[model samples]
Target: VKRFVHISVTNPDIDSPFAYFKGKAIMEQTLIGSGLSYAIIRPTLIFGKEDILINNIAWILKRFPVYAVFGDGEYRVQPVYAGDLAKLAVELSKTSENIICDAVGPETYTFRRLVTLIKNRVGSSAKIVNTNPKMAFLISKILNLLVRDVVVTREEIYGLMADTIVSNEKPRCSTSFSNWLEKNADLLGTNYVSELNRHFKKINEDAGYRISG
Candidate 1:
């Protein structure tokens, strides 16, 4: 039998305030009830070649003159490289038994440190500054209007302020976000693309906006 492999987020429980997280928990339940041997891989803040979060941060830094940090910015995050997670997914799919594990990178970085790493690695000229969550939201909204793109979403601001992206257990992957950023510096922020445009808006060859990853 071909092993069933599922990818999920780290925390997907009913108690989660976020609707997406709760829905993921329900999705996991459905998968488990399928009675098929499966492996579930949960990753915390995945980072890799042209990833949404990491690359978007670079995109903002590239275009903007300022970057805002919510509060003290001590929140932690463990990022798994997409390549490492894909490799692990293949390995887990090869196994027959039901399994669930967190896929995280070996290193942990605080929010401020994460921003700093991206800025330094990408050679951003944007001035990084600490601001209250409220002010950050206002600034982002203004930026969104000016840029004609969703500079930052309200949910993203909440997620960042909540600082719920880190994993407590040991990481299963060896890829480092800092190293990967250094290596891919040339292509990280070549353009600022929206998620909707990437997944949609280009169903046909000439329908609308062309999507890229």
Candidate 2:
């Protein structure tokens, strides 16, 4: 029997209010009930050469002198490397057992610490400011208008604050976030990556891509 590999989130629940979590849960259920030998890979934050969140954070840090931290920023995140995740997926794909694993890195950092690390790695002189979620979301919305891209979403804020992106399971990936950041700091946020332009428009038209409904 051919095995099916599904990439999912850290904590997925059918009753989750956030569409991301809820949708992932629904898909997991659909796949599990499909009677196929399946392996579910639930990764926390995935960071690499082409990641959005970390790169965007670096981008904002490079441009803005002030960086906003929603709430106290005590939330924790466990980021797994994209290469490690791919290797795990490939290894599991060759198996016939029904398994579920959390693909997480070796280190866990508080939100504040994570941002500070990135700031240092990018050599940014930005000041980190703690603000309420509402204010942060508003700022992100304004940035969305300015950049013509979804900078961040309210759901993303909620999920981050709720600490839903961290996993308690044994770390399954070996890459260190700090090491990766140090090596890629120069190339991290030199250019802003637009999700809409990458997905909705042609790659060649990125220079003048216009968002349309």
Candidate 3:
């Protein structure tokens, strides 16, 4: 291949306790050492039609009377549009230089502010409550059981609290999340998306049928 483009998370660290971040870091290192012209596109939160985070946040807010904010919720996030990230990856693949860059959006928002914006746009009356991360995590576990899906992970909370997703580099994508949300607010969170069902359960079911055959 002339060039390889890899999608990775922002501020990934091999030493990170979180599997998601650690795994990304490991893959990035492996690719970099492979002696290929590579471009590593590190994105923060990516929002689009098939997104989990923003959609789920809207889902929770629309259904629940109260929403919890873990810790002070001041940590910042820079969300890039999925389309924009994809375009950047395609653009980088044509280049021969080994490059590493952040693919963040045009706007940044604090965690609390982001939730509140979603709340307003979705026209939800849920009360935003600030709670300790421990309590929030416990609640997430309970919700996970109720929904039969992973609501939130402890590591995700830790990453959000650390503000690891935001970058000091200039925004590389032009799509504004807030603007996109304005147009898509009515459709978001109308249905819940299940990670297990979308990924693992299907694989398991396919494997079972293959074994039976």
**Best candidate (score: lDDT):** 2
All candidates: TM-score: 0.88, 0.94, 0.94
Candidate closest to the true structure, highest TM-score = 3
Residue 87 of model 2, lDDT score: 99
Q: Model 2 — TM-score against the truth?
A: 0.94
User: What does candidate 3's lDDT look like per residue over 1-213, in tens digits?
Assistant: 878899999999999888898999999999999998899999999999899889999999999999999999899999999999999999999889999999999899999999999999999999999999999999999998877888888988988998889989999999999999999999998988877776677677877842111
Worst 10 residues of 2 by lDDT: 204-213
Tens-digit lDDT track of model 2 for 26-59: 9999999999999999999999998988998999
RMSD of each: 2.7, 2.8, 2.8
Question: Candidate 3, which ten residues in sequence have the lowest lDDT sum?
Answer: 204-213
Q: Which regions of candidate 3 fall more than 4 Å away from where they truly are? A: 209-213
Higher-lDDT candidate of 1 and 3: 3
Candidate 2 ranges with C-alpha deviation above 4 Å = 202-213
Worst 10 residues of 1 by lDDT: 204-213
